[model samples]
Target: MSTYKKYFAAMALIWAGCAVVIILAYLLLFAPQSRRRLQTENQLKETKRAYRAGLKAGQKDAQDLAREQIQQMQHGLANFVTDAESSANLIFDLSQIANARQLDSFTIKAKDDREKSEMSDYKNIGENHIDVSFTGDFNQFATFLNAMERHQPVIFVDQFKITRPKRQGTANNVNMSLAVFVRKNNES
Candidate 1:
């Protein structure tokens, strides 16, 4: 071949080799990198969707748990009150407790119910007061108080007056007022 043709052929060969290298670099490096980046982006989007769904489900579970707890509390509160029959039963129970404690005397009388204010959360709630009188030793009185606390229908000691007898052998006299919450039978 002539010198100019040989130089032209060498240049053409070099150009073709450079083009091949460029194509190989794109296929080996850039193409795989772009594919991996696309895969990572899709995984990230899927993870975010799953996280949001889990968050929504968790919120719903929390709300349900709170509602269930409130219902349980309401039911527990319902057990703290006594109806008319239960009130009579409670008086009898108190008498029994006093007898068990060996008190000198014991009496229980129910008073009128106290109405709650309209603005109160317990609007239909009423207080049933019970006047209790007992004569006993200090130990017996303490036992009586403890028994009252552990009794059903949840009695609350409103007020009390204690008087010691003039004679040492005589028992101490105690007058106490107790109260318990009850649902009103008739709503106004």
Candidate 2:
């Protein structure tokens, strides 16, 4: 080979080796760094998003929540009642729920006034527990309990119990106590 041709061949071989080294360097180093940087960016974004959501939740958790609850309590307290007519009407309402649920042998009776006179703390909120017993399927009983919980007078379940059915395909016997917290109205 001529000297000039050998020189050209050597230069071409050096260029090819440099290109291989550059490719190896990129595969070994730069690509991994880019992947790590992308991962770090995603993590940073997620952390910032969580921080912003926490800030929004923190704003909601302020004293305004307490004030809102107090307002609700005041609104509920406005419906306090303690008269024979009110008690009778409330009983009728409960019987209506039992009837709607198709419960058998439903019975409800309000506890006497001695339980009411004891009052509940400084709020004067007293709970009058009513004895209730009925025979029904589980579905009907569940719906009855749901209706009682969402009743307009704010009824709460106190004592709840259930007995197994005496025979297969028979209704279960259930006995429950419900409570109503009410302040005495001036008219009473």
Candidate 3:
């Protein structure tokens, strides 16, 4: 009976040592793996948050740039409208201009730059020349030219011709023809 009791006690001590070893092995292996998994999860969450913040900031910058461009275009359009209105009101008083010139038959010819040999050079040119023919004395023709020169907006006269009446019945009248050029002020 004494020998059996000693064997039973030895077996119990071995079982208890095996149980302790198993517990230590599980803790050493699995604890490190679980801790590493938790750290990885936290890192993934931080990365997602940073990406979201950056995306939001990028969207805001795009919106601001679009708004700034729209405002600039609007300002440019307003300035263009003001300038167009000013230019449209710049036509001279034709009746008064004609009376000052002693003009009988006044005809205006407007040729666009599209007809120019160098089309690009005259694209912005808005100029017209008035071809005037009148039966008047030399003094009246000279006074008309003088008046045109003294006008606020300058008129350029290029071609001039005066002829005595070819027929006997129209001896008192002189046939005169002249070209007067006027420019539209688009800068206003």
Evaluate model 3: give its TM-score: 0.36
Model 2 C-alpha lDDT per residue in residues 1-188, reported as the tens digit of each score: 69999999999999999999999999999999999999999999999999987776578575577679988987766555344336567788999889989899999988875453445553545567788999988898899999987777777787889999878888899999877766545443
Give candidate 1's total backbone clashes. 0
Query: 12-74 in candidate 1: lDDT tens per residue?
Result: 999999999999999999999999999999999999999987787579786788789999998
The pairs that clash in candidate 1 are none
lDDT of each: 0.82, 0.81, 0.57
Give the residue spans of candidate 3 off by over 4 A: 1-94, 100-125, 168-188
Number of backbone-clashing residue pairs for each candidate, in the order shown: 0, 0, 0
Q: Give the C-alpha lDDT of model 3.
A: 0.57
* Residue 14 lDDT (model 2): 100
Q: Could you tell me every candidate's TM-score relative to the true structure?
A: 0.58, 0.53, 0.36
Task: Answer with 1 or 2, whichever has the higher TM-score.
Answer: 1
lDDT of predicted model 2: 0.81
**Candidate 2 local lDDT, residue 15:** 100
Q: Candidate 2 regions off by >4 Å?
A: 1-73, 79-85, 113-123, 185-188
User: Largest TM-score belongs to which candidate?
Assistant: 1
- Model 2: residue 3 alpha-carbon error in angstroms: 88
Sort by lDDT, top down from the best? 1, 2, 3
